[model samples]
Target: MDTLTCHPCPLDAAELARAGRDDPATGALGEELAARHLVADGCDLVARNWRLYAGELRGELDLIGVDTAEGCVVVCEVKARRDASRFGGALSAVPPRKAAKIRALTAAFLREARLPYPRVRLDVIAVDLGRDPVLHHVLAAL
Candidate 1:
């Protein structure tokens, strides 16, 4: 498994704490943090919050990046939590159904974008917004 250690962002902890779980800003901040971490890890981000609709299936992909070394397209699902312990942490937040949906969305993206990558990967980036912010990247998560 490939992983990267990320430091806290400039966003104030107080603001995030007050935002709570339903706040869109909190999730947006998590996506931003995940994107930065991916870039730092040598992945080139190609998309963020990409929404797709095919027939009756519709969903959004949080982040899409290319592993520079392996030339693999990576579809990332980002989960953010105020506390790591609550709700099984951000890492385990993605259930099997969600993973399956992500895979379908990835297929749609690949077909629509006509990306020539030899392989594709599913990843999850968990953002813990406790006293000390932590970012965990799980490669090939699904």
Candidate 2:
């Protein structure tokens, strides 16, 4: 079994945000927090930022984890915003169209990797970058 471990360089969200001038720092921080949250929930990290492209179609899964307790591959979509009021939080970001793409991407990932199609489920990790970061996880979200 191939797995990836996260070794996050010690940095606070503000520092990270400053470093990521082009993109919001909360994105990286949120993924890191989500990964840790998954581990705490008894899931093993399979991959992070796993990307695949076929022809003009390209997709990226923020975090892929195996929930050993549930015996399912957890394909997580991460959404981060500076505040919940910005766009109705992370969950709102994943519209029907995005969810459909994630579903298709999950299948493609399994086929391209030549891995058995385990019972797969989609999850969403919503990160609210307030004064203190808060994460809201919705399992089988889509």
Candidate 3:
């Protein structure tokens, strides 16, 4: 298991909008913030927005990183929302079905990448872009 640290850095909606003309939503910003948070926690990120399609089964992993201390592959799913009040926060958005799909995708990633890690963990990084923007990390969520 890996320990997580919370940082206080609120994202500026106006700045983000100006920065990326392509993405109108805050999802891209959230993913970037999550990736930075992981690196700050001593995790070496291997891939971002990794998509795998094994026949009819297709899934996309938000972030994939290696925990340097634990020597395990961490598969992260990031959910970003401007207001979490509607959906009970970004963390709660990932239901059982979504979690199962993430697990399946992780397996496919391992098979394709042939990563030699002893352990693989599923994680979720929820980014709240509300009044108090927060980046919450749930380790070994699945």
Candidate 4:
């Protein structure tokens, strides 16, 4: 497995540890770590922080990964917390502003990347940073 260190994060790990319930900093490193995890699981990563299209209607997809599974492009939004208690509040953490952007961004990514796929899935990998980093992946969003 290949591991890449994300140095000089705008917010330090210590800062993420004490992030508020709905704070964006909650286990922020999990995105990079989770991206690695997905790659290790055999997903072909096409883009990281894919900012496709523009203007009042644009999107910023976090990760765009591909695999043979259903010929799908997986759009992953990662959320991580310190422990199990942080679970219930974790999924609620991805603010509408960010989520909306991601939703639009993924669309632009697909449109611009010209990814030919019969199936596209949006997923959220929520991790509770407990003993082993709990991951709750949501297949679809409402």
Q: Best candidate per TM-score, number?
A: 3
Task: Write the residue-wise lDDT of candidate 4 on 69-141 in tens digits.
Answer: 6578888887767665645634666776887777777777777788887677777766665444445556663
Clashes of each: 0, 0, 0, 1
List ranges where model 2 is wrong by over 4 Å.
1-22
Q: What's the true lDDT of residue 31 in model 4?
A: 77
Instruction: Tell me each candidate's TM-score.
Output: 0.84, 0.79, 0.85, 0.66
Candidate 1 lDDT trough over 10 residues, lowest sum? 2-11
What candidate 1 gets wrong by more than 4 Å, as runs, is: 1-22
Candidate 3 per-residue C-alpha lDDT over 1-142 given as tens digits, one digit per residue, 9 for 90 to 100: 6445455656676844533344345678778888988898888999998997659789799999999698899999988777777657777888989999999898888888887888888988888776677788888733
Cα lDDT of all candidates, in order?
A: 0.81, 0.73, 0.80, 0.65
- Across residues 1-142, which tens digit of lDDT does each residue of candidate 1 receive? 5655455645566656553656476687788788988898789999998997658889999999999798889899998887676657777788889999999899898988887788998988888877677788778733
Best candidate, lDDT: 1
1 Cα displacement, candidate 4 (Å): 31
Among all windows of 10 consecutive residues in model 3, the one with the lowest summed lDDT is 15-24
Ranking by lDDT: 1, 3, 2, 4
- Error of model 1, residue 98, in angstroms: 0.7
Better of 3 and 4 by TM-score: 3
- Candidate RMSDs in Å, in order, are 2.8, 6.3, 3.0, 7.9
Candidate 2: give its CA RMSD in angstroms: 6.3
